[model samples]
Target: MHSSAVFLIEFGAIILGLGLLGRIAGRLKFSPIPLYLLAGLAFGEGGLLPLGASEEFVAIGAEIGVILLLLMLGLEYTATDLVTNLRTQYPAGLVDAALNALPGAAMALLLGWGPVAAVVLAGVTWISSSGVIAKVLGDLGRLGNRETPVVLSILVLEDLAMAVYLPIVTALLAGVGLAAGSVTLAVALGVAGLVLFLAVRYGRLISRFVSSDDPEKLLLVVLGLTLLVAGLAQQLQVSAAVGAFLVGIALSGEVAEGAHNLLSPLRDLFAAVFFVFFGLHTDPASIPPVLLPALALAVVTAATKIATGYWAARRSGISVKGRWRAGGTLVARGEFSIVIAGLAVTAGIEPSLGPLATAYVLILVVLGPLTARYTEPLATRLSRLTRRHRPDTSAGDAPPALASEGPALTVDPDTAMSGSATHMTLPPSRGGS
Candidate 1:
């Protein structure tokens, strides 16, 4: 009875605190994720006042949080959308992997952790936070922008890549040999392909089976199915988050939409708990030791993410402003980065990985929204400044005869940079001879 009472009080207090933090962030026009993580750190093992009874329950809730996060992400699009993105946006995905992932791998190696740790850290840096990015887009009213689809396509590709990447990491962390790892990889691929096929071919039927007009029944059924599948996947040596995501993909139509609405509140609650759970495991004191490396990693990866986004958006023919916006939007790494690092930390890979990842994510999550809002204007200002200070090289060149006749031959930054214009007008040359 005493334990139950303690659990209730602690859990209730957590919920209440999260609500207040969320309200504060809303008022401040910012994300509450960093604040949520800080709260967890404060209440965790090394912090001010750690909870006794609720820690176990919070752990379970955190697992559920990860599953729900992946599941809801799946519901955002159809199987067709996934296929289309994989086919068309694969180059961007590859670029993203190369630019963002290599830095983490290099860092891990430089720290003398083995190849397995390198692979794990690679994933930690590769993925962007879809939840945070989506929220920012909605908050900033950028959903209708020309570059938004480009951003979403890249995000979807990354999520799909996780379906494959997570299983490999799981196998590596488990210390499986080549034959066993191959089998595991094969099974994971088969499962993923089969789920995609079913989702594409019979999604409506599957949704009908799971659907109910009654909200209570609907929530129970959906949540139960997700947990069951996730558990079984784990038992099969596959990642549970992948299983939950597959289940989400296999549902469509009104059922998908209904389940999404019913489960959103639950997702938010558990997701917050997951972030806190990550913080709980990380010792705040450990962070300061690795703070310099983490800060360096954050800075390097932020630039690479921006480059990846800029290249992808430019390839898609978005305007200059849209390209910068796309780059900046992909800068934040939140839940997934923590999830990857948590797996490594749990596997006893490296003591310092957790703290470094925590600090890195905290820095980027805070910087992400600000960059998304300001990157374009900043880039524009810098470009103008560069032009203003550039030395003139056309002093001896003759001005074009059409320059005076063609409205001064002004160039639109977007048109010129996007390569959409057929003709370029040389800047009116300085008079010579």
Candidate 2:
């Protein structure tokens, strides 16, 4: 009873604090994610205060947060959208992976963390925060922008890659041999393929099966199904997040819309907790020691992400401003980065990875929104300045003038009438005939 009382008080305070923080962020026109992380830091191991009873509960909530994050992301598009984006935007995805992931891998190797840590860090840098990006899009009213599809396509491909990447990382961290790892990878791919196929073919029927007029029933059914699939996927050495995402992809139409509306609040609540949980795991003192490296990684990856987005958007024929927005929007690395680092930290792969990731995410998450709002305009200003200073070769050149006698019309000679007025006269010819 005493423990229960303590749990209630602690959890209640945490939620209330989160709500207030969110309110403040909303008023200030800022993301509440960094604030949540700060709150967790304050309540975590080396901070001003720490909670004893509610930690475990918060941990569970954090896991749900991640599952729901991925689930809702999957709900945002249909199976056809996913397949089409993969087919058409795969080059962008590849460019994204190559540009953003390399710096982290190189840094890990420079830090002497070995091949495993390099791979883990590469994943950390590769994925952008879908939750954050989605929120930014809604906040800034960029959901309907020309470049938004390109952005979503890249994000979807990253999430899909995570479905495979997480399992492989898990096997590697566990020291599984080649044969065992291959089996794990194969299982993950097979399950993902099967779920995708079902979603594409029978999505409507599946939606009907889960659909309910009652919001309560709909909510319960969708949440229960997601948790069940996520659990089973985890049991099979695949990512629980992937399972939840696939479950989301399998539901469309009214069912998806209803589920999205019903689960959005829950998603927001759990997602906040997840960010806090990430902060809870890191010690404040450890961050300063790794702050330099984290800052360096953040800066390098930020530019690479911008390049990746610009290239992708340009390829898709998005305008200059839209391409800049796409690049800036992809700069924030949040949930997935933490998720990847959490796995490495849990496996004791690298002692410093956690703190570095914490600091890195903090820097980028704060910078992300700023960049998204300003990058395009800033680029435009710089471009104008460059053009102003550029030498004008065209100033010395003159355009050819047409004959002043009258307006001249050019016609194709191949289709012109033979010997019948090659060029029309302004006035009818007098006695020249």
Candidate 3:
């Protein structure tokens, strides 16, 4: 009885504090993620005031938070959309993985963390924070930009990749033998394929069965199904998050929208708790030793993400500025990074890995919004400065390819949002390079 009371009081205080922090973040037009982590640091082990009664509850909430995050991410697109993106934008996705995932893998191996840890860290660096990037796009009013589709395509590819990657990590972390691991991988892939097929073929029926005019019933049904499926997937070593994501993909139309609305608040609450939970496990003292490496990794990965985006946008014939904008927008790695690292932490892989990931995410998440806003302008300014210092060349000296570089085709946000952006093409220009 005494413990229950303490738990309630502590949990209530933490919730209230989170509310205040969230409001402050809203007013400042920044992500609350960093603030949440700082709060956790202050209230965690070896901090000013460590949490006792609510720590376990926070951990559970954190897991739910990840499930909900992936679920809603799945809800954003239909299975057909996924197939279309995979077919059309695969080159960009490949580039994205190569440029972004490699650095983290290299860093992990350099640190002598072995192959499993390397895979985990590679995922940590590979994915951009969909939540943060979405919010940033809306805030910056760049949702309609020509490059936004390119940005989102890369993100979608990453999310789809996670559906496979998480299961592999689970098998690795469990130290499963070759035959068992093969079975696990096969099951995961087969299940993913079956879900995608059913979703494409009969998504309407699935949504109709779950949907209700009553929002309360709708919410309960969808949430219940998601948890059930997630649990079963975990039992099969396929990853609960992936299962929740697949459930979401199977839901479409009005049902998906309704569930998303009903769960948004819960997602926000639990997601905040998730970030705090990650911070809690990480010793504040451990961060400094890893801070330099984290910063270096951040700098390198940021550049690679930018390059990936720029290359993708350019391939699609976007203007130079739009390419830069796309690149900058891809630089932030938030919840997903922590999610990947959290797996390694739970497996007790490397003590320093958690701190390194925490520091890396902290640096990037805060820097992400700033980059989304300024990278284009910064690049433009540098270009002008470089031009001013360079020797003047005659018109004929300019390369033909440079002269033909033209304005990119513009796409409405709705069109790109709908996955019809595969048809978008750039127009050739006879004007300036």
Candidate 4:
């Protein structure tokens, strides 16, 4: 068969599988990440077929996915949610990244990879699956809840850490050795990032000016700006994800309601193409020899994120059940990890590590949805344990099930920042870029 035709068949098959298996996973109470990963495996390297993947297409879709995902995330950033609660959340976000990154890197080193490959592996493992978290939260109808803002903020912080760390790591891989120049570049990027944050903070000028219901105008302007900024960031030797995220952040307010109309169609089409190409890249037969190591790495990656994220979430003052739910929700690795791993591969960081990274993501994606599918039941049990241990406490303090409505939004004299956009000024809640 012609490559193009085979590619289309594989793409169609994947989409079909995702939809069907997603429903199946829903019924089985399993997370969908594992399903997607399994789909990749079945259709990819070791499966019944291969598509001879195109790195370019997958990379682009992954890029846009991060942008759209983060754009939506940023719009949720009201003044109260982002600005007023930094002291605690910011530190906790750093801790979350550190806790995940350090252990994963150590594990990689134990596998005999040196510091550079280990670090790259660590970055690949460090990020949690934001897409899975968002899906489960929305399904539980908790996407708009107060805790969501906190979780979203932490995810944002992780992205920022990756944006900074990626360039430094890339430089090291290139034999730049983390010199003064790299440090200076990192600092400059931070300062520039702060400027971007400030613009998002007080500058409602763009949103107030060009906001519209026209999807074409919005997509062109919003996506064009994202691409431009992404290009600029690349010129500066920074991660393009940073630039794309900043563009999304700046346009968050203007695009929130109409975002689906503008980006969803294009996102769906392009993203499908992206995944198809991603599947085609691997020769599944080649993965057999490394499967054990990959599985081992994947297990460590999931455990580290769950344990550390749970600990960090708890320390951030979330309830025990909230912590477990958050940690479990984050257990999946998705497009972002794949993007970074692909980058590592392209840059020649280490030949073997690239497949290892891909294998790790595939494993996590397959397992994530299965875990998330049953999250509520598990959360209920955990919440019960907490309640039994302390019966006198109000239910309001604990994370409630999705079937229940949370405490009615109430005004607190001590904490007057209600759900208004003005209240969203909580210091760029936990985004990475």
lDDT of 4 by residue, 23-54 (tens): 88789754554555555556655577644543
The local lDDT score (0 to 100) that residue 348 gets in candidate 2 is 88
Query: Best-fitting candidate, measured by lDDT?
Result: 3
Query: Residues 211-257, candidate 3, lDDT per residue (tens digit)?
Result: 89999999889889999999999999999999999998899887888
Error of 3 at 301 (Å): 0.3
Which residues of candidate 4, in runs, are more than 4 Å off? 1-85, 142-150, 180-184, 187-194, 316-319, 369-433
Ranking by lDDT: 3, 1, 2, 4
- The lDDT for every candidate, in the order shown, is 0.87, 0.85, 0.89, 0.61
- Candidate with the larger lDDT of 1 and 3: 3
Q: Candidate 4 at residue 431, lDDT?
A: 30
Window of ten residues with lowest summed lDDT in model 3 = 424-433
For model 3 the TM-score comes to 0.91
**Stretches of candidate 3 exceeding 4 Å from the true structure:** 395-433
Query: Which residue pairs in candidate 2 collide?
Result: none
lDDT at residue 233 of model 1 (Cα atoms): 91
Q: Residue pairs in steric clash, candidate 3?
A: none
